[model samples]
Target: MSHSRRSILGAALGLPAAVAVGTVATATPAAAAAVDATAWTNLELETGITPQPGATPQVRTVTILGTTFLQARGAITCNLAADTKIGTLPAAMTPPTWYVRATSPRNNSQGINACRFEVNTAGSVTIYGATSGNPITWVQFDSVQTIWR
Candidate 1:
């Protein structure tokens, strides 16, 4: 005799959906072994900051997943005006790996737009300018994807 899937399963297991979904935990040992070898410890932006600070700060935030994916972007301003105040990462990143960089200068100031930044494991980030470097104003942005298990 022929039987529908639901009829065969529901009659035999008393629940077609449960049986179809393999809800029978005792049916296999693999079901119980579905635990993650590397549990998802945490998740966050690579740069941490979505935007820096200034009259026209341009910044972006990125969310890094696992150990194989990243996305970063931002929008900033540059005009060789006052030291440009881009955005900053939040205080929640990897660590001991802090470094800063300067976007392309808007005008020709002989490296007047140089900058420095820091990133602690705990996610604390800070950005500073060189003694000779100042900010600008146009529209420049950056992103850094930092992730950890």
Candidate 2:
């Protein structure tokens, strides 16, 4: 009776093993080495902001790697009491409407804000800003990039 019980247990284990072997055999090479769609590469952006307020205005350039994504954020500010204005010229000056705004005196306000840009090509992007009469304080911008190869 004990020998018969052992045989029945062996058969039960063997049945599952056979099924697993069959499943493995049916699996394609592509399925076994399935490519992960969610995989991503490490991306970094070398960022810098210039004309540290009270200094000469200079062009700020950021370099990014090949076929990458770019994002930028910036703020230009001046003391409204001092009669200062902020303007943005993206690529060119000609416009049906040239956009310019007065810097908000509100402490938390991001005066003269600009959004991100998508760059798929390898190059340098220059952002320019200037202050007229009295020197502007803490006028700056920043950018970051991510590259997937």
Candidate 3:
């Protein structure tokens, strides 16, 4: 006997009737395993900020798919004339977790700027000056837990 397309698909899937069930199958251990957030608890930036004339900010690696998350704070630039702002990190950054920022110096005086970072995986990140206008100072403060999933 020959099976129709419906029968073939059903047989292949090992399901009952053609009536589609709204419920989806749960992911197996191999398919979806829980990520450990604690592994990235102590992740930190390896490099410091390097000021330049028009250099772009850097994105350091952090973590992903974990239960715990990390929050980091640091300083970027010391250019008093221009206003410095931190930029968002890359999407799905794994190994080299990092972030970037831009500096706008209003004057020549030195200015101290600060920033914070949060990671959801066990990873490391770095923050560096993006612009070449003036070399910005960097200072990492601390990493704290924000949420656990």
Candidate 4:
């Protein structure tokens, strides 16, 4: 019968207590190897992204290897359903990856906000989270640092 280490130890030592996992100090060889193998290299470029003129201000850029990431660190505020250019991309989102995604909207009280974002061939980013109400100012837009290769 295959007995757990705990059962064997309990029977031997007569200690009727449950022991939490990771009792041993050193890591197992397989665990160590798995950790070493699954290393990530998500790089951030030193260059900064310049924001266009509007309420939708403050855009940042970070590059990793050949891939480029355009990110908005803070809440990107947009003015009244206007098409505010968020920031420029490294290259145009091609036909295959033409559509970019936006996640985690900061505010969704009144209605669902729309991420009207577009990447042009000349590497221009035009995006805004706008509401449907009159004089609708969208607040707190969250995007996951859209990447371009």
Estimate candidate 3's RMSD in Å.
15.2
TM-score versus the correct structure, for each prediction: 0.29, 0.19, 0.25, 0.38
Query: Model 3, range 47-140, lDDT digits (tens) per residue?
Result: 4333333333333323344322333333343332223333333445443233222222222313534333333234323333324555434433
Tens-digit lDDT track of model 1 for 44-136: 323322323442232233322222211233433333333323333432423333333333323234655433333334444334442334433
lDDT tens readout by residue for model 2, 19-91: 9788778988776344333222212222333333443222222223222222233433334323222332233
TM-score of 4: 0.38
**How do the residues 76-141 of candidate 4 rate in per-residue lDDT, one tens digit apiece?**
433544445555443322221444444534345455644555455554555455434532243333
Candidate with more favorable, higher TM-score: 2 or 4: 4
Alpha-carbon runs more than 4 Å astray in model 2:
1-53, 67-77, 80-85, 88-138, 142-149
Worst 10 residues of 4 by lDDT: 36-45
Top lDDT: which candidate number?
A: 4
Give me the candidate number with maximum TM-score.
4
lDDT of each: 0.35, 0.32, 0.34, 0.42
Candidate 1's C-alpha lDDT?
A: 0.35
The alpha-carbon deviation from the true structure for residue 104 of candidate 3, after best TM-score superposition, in angstroms, is 18
Ranking by lDDT: 4, 1, 3, 2
> Stretches of candidate 4 above 4 Å error?
1-56, 82-106, 128-136
**Cα lDDT for residue 148, candidate 2:** 23
